[model samples]
Target: MSATHALRSRLRALALTAGLIAAGAAAAQTGSGYFRYGDARLSLAHAIAVIEEPSDQADERRTLVFLSAQPLDAAAVAAAFDAMDAVREQAPAGGYVRLCIAADGSECGLFYSPEGFNSGGYGDLALQRNEAARIAGRWQLAEGDFLGTPYDFDLRFDTPIAPAPGSALPAGGGAPGAAYNAWLEALAKGDVAALRRMGGEDARGRFPEDDAGTVKESLKSLRDGEPLQARIARGRQHGDQAVLWVEGVDRDDIRRRGRVLMRRTAAGWQHAESDLSSVDE
Candidate 1:
């Protein structure tokens, strides 16, 4: 070959070698790149895109099913977990497959974690009779790839409630102690007027206007019962608003613990909201 032709050939060879080296390096960094199952090959990003987020954050209990035509890889499994912001725990050795609701209300896609079960049993993603077979129809499972078909799942929601913040009868303040306490006292007294005075003009609109009448009916039933006392616990505070763990007990020994959210208003204080809790119930 002529000298010029030899140099051109050498340059082409050099370019090919560089391209191969670059491709090899790229593959190592991303761990096998796009996974190939059978007919379908998907990148990690694409695989994760298959799952969709649920509608309500309050709907914490959710289960998802994935029917895999074949075994899955670590990366594929990790991708599935990321879709739900969940973790996985190893199935306990020789233990009964524990199937239970997850704390975050999500089942683990693979392994169980402190939060929930990872895999196996009805608790994990349940498979349809032929779901995996259906997926295998479109694409066979391969060593490097994963395929999942749709399946049904449900969540057992443990009811939840927010804790109240704490507040005290500010320093020497009395009669109108803590905002929450004042509301409790007014409630105990069947004192609508007192509630309105402390709650401001908005009081009537705020409380069940007609419900104020019911307090007397309730009091009449308990006339022979003990007087009510307000106790606060697990107190937490935020700015002018304070939440209190409140409880009431009567002569009959009936007890109930609740959360009361109170805010400091110009009139003194007012109750913002309340709910029953098991802490002292």
Candidate 2:
């Protein structure tokens, strides 16, 4: 071959070798990541990050579901658990899982981290067919990639509310029920007078009439790609004070959302600041 032709061929060969080396590195990065629970490995497909978040209380904040590059299968799920186990064998943290199956567990779910299960979740995400509460599992991880695992290994959820559309009131929420009703009426009819009456006793009162009316009008139009369709989920009483949670239902994900706090007042329940936060593990 001529010198020019030989030089071109050598350059092409060099480029090919470089491309192969790059491809190998990409593959290593793809499979290099994994979190372990005991001996179980959890491949880092995607994660539901909730580092310092309280597991209870459903809200409308979107739960971030980490999507695996590949569709999650039973085998991949098992691999992911293996990764989780690898981490757990260390720091020796405590974690739990909630699995559901048919009448017979012919089909069963791989044990999932509570963070994974509850991340970005509003209300309860029922994993059991009978709507059973959580089933605790134990695993320990070192300085691995996980948030604080539960300690007691106790299932704190009594009725474990899922993020579907329904009114799952807690044992005692009547204290705030009146206030919630007032809100419903005010919103339904765009009643600014009721808003003024229920406003907080501060300089700004609670919600101004104009603001309330504007809010109602906006909510009436919330169906167009709205993140939350506010609804009363449940509440608890603290003597004269009570806290009612309004679920911000995610119309898109169909599985994630956050919570907003509504506290009982002399007139009724007054809207309060939202506790919106998240984590990673």
The numbered model that scores best in lDDT is 1
Off by over 4 Å in 1: 1-122, 125-151, 154-177, 199-202, 206-227, 250-252, 277-281
lDDT of 1 by residue, 60-176 (tens): 323332222222232333233132332123222221111222224333333222223243333233222112111111111123212352222232111111111234543323333
- lDDT of every model, 2 decimals: 0.39, 0.37
Model 2 lDDT tens row, 176-275: 6556445545544545566556544531443344576655544454222222434545554544444444443333444322333355566657644333
* Best prediction by TM-score: 1
lDDT of model 1, residue 278: 30
User: What's the TM-score of every candidate structure?
Assistant: 0.35, 0.29
Lowest summed lDDT across 10 adjacent residues in model 2 is found at 152-161
Candidate 2 wrongly placed segments (more than 4 Å): 1-172, 202-232, 248-257, 274-281
